[model samples]
Target: MLKEKVALITGSTSGIGLATAHVLAQQGINLVLHGLVSATEGQALANDFIAQYGINAIFDDADLQDVASIERLITKAISTMGSVDILVNNAGIQHTQSAESFPLEKWNAIIAINLSAAFHAIQFALPAMKRQGWGRIINVASVHGLVGSVNKSAYCAAKHGLVGLTKVLALECAEQGITVNAICPGWVDTPLINDQISAIAKQQDSSFEQAKYQLVTAKQPLPEMMAPAQIGEFILFLCSDSAKSITGAALPMDGAWTAQ
Candidate 1:
């Protein structure tokens, strides 16, 4: 369905973003992948995609925390890919700490990358999408966007801001053929969460599997982590014509975390 379309996914070198890129490519969407990986690694990933899918693919090393860098990256993507029809703002960072003791720099960096960068990407991508008269903006938010989490002040705040941004942008673009929405996912088994799981294992003196189970089932009734590929599939669905009417929605794939 995405044949001839171009998608720009940020922080796509690993985890959810990478999975989403793969899914999009499978649907024949050309990709503009962004991440903080070394240039060599980024090129290698791009080459792998080109070889596997035979779809046009390129990678840009974007520092999501830097607005100028993001702008440059978006410009470069547009220049190389011609135009972006689907934009997935999936770049973000997580820090767990008490709000009172939260490092100000860390808070600022999280907000800039997780929240502000989305705004910047939309701002830059919208004109081209408007010219094309159709577009999709997908924000990879977290369950924290719909609820709260302990010791995750920065993450919660940034995701909440992203959710709000999605709503407002969706409303603004409703008259146009553009849709804006957020995917609020629960605990996903990604490399990013590996550190947290390892820390938990050490703290409890349990095996990695035990710690993973404890974390996954803490507040969620689910016994497993949601796969990044699942989230990618949902995104693919959203980019379809059937989801054209679905806008300004914060759809949760939280394993019922927000259900209780």
Candidate 2:
């Protein structure tokens, strides 16, 4: 049922978004990959996907901070690939500081890209989905969406808002053959976590592996971080017919972080 369907995924140039795109492309879904990369660089990734997966793929460098750009992103997806059957609001930026010390510009940028962009994308994509009578909207919220952490006020607030938006949209689309859900993942092995681990190692004069262990075990009971591809697999499951009944859930793939 997923074959030939078009999926629009923001932040698809790398990390979880890229992994998810691979999973969906392997299933024969055409893709509208979005990121901040240059068009030439983005097209190279798109060409690679086509060569390896034999599916249609295109790239867009839409600025998620701009509502007009986000609307155009959805428009381009539908115009270029027929209709956006799947929408993944995955583009996000993060800045960590005490709430009182947080820069107002950083806070605004974080909220714009992380929360507001998703809203605009959903608004534009919904009409196409409504006309087709089937759609899947997956928001890649963080574990912070479910819980909280020190010095991450803005990130937490935006992700928490994303989860809330997911629930409300799910309720509104419950009878319309559409499902909206959020995935709350703990530390996934991405460049972002790698940088944090590197800093921890430097600060404590510890080995990389030791720093990684300390990092993951501090909050997550599981000592190892999840791979980006693992999150991709979970997302694929959410897009399947078997998951048709699941909606509005901020499902945790956090290795028991919230369980604590």
Per-candidate Cα lDDT values, in order, are 0.93, 0.94
Clashing pairs in 2: none
Mind giving the per-residue lDDT tens digits that candidate 1 earns over 124-150? 899989988999999999899989988
Per-residue lDDT of 117-159 in model 2, one digit per residue for the tens?
9999999999889998999999999999999999999999999
Q: Give the root-mean-square deviation of each candidate in angstroms.
A: 1.1, 0.7
Judging by lDDT against the true structure, name the best candidate: 2
Error of 2 at 100 (Å): 0.8
What TM-score should be assigned to candidate 1? 0.97
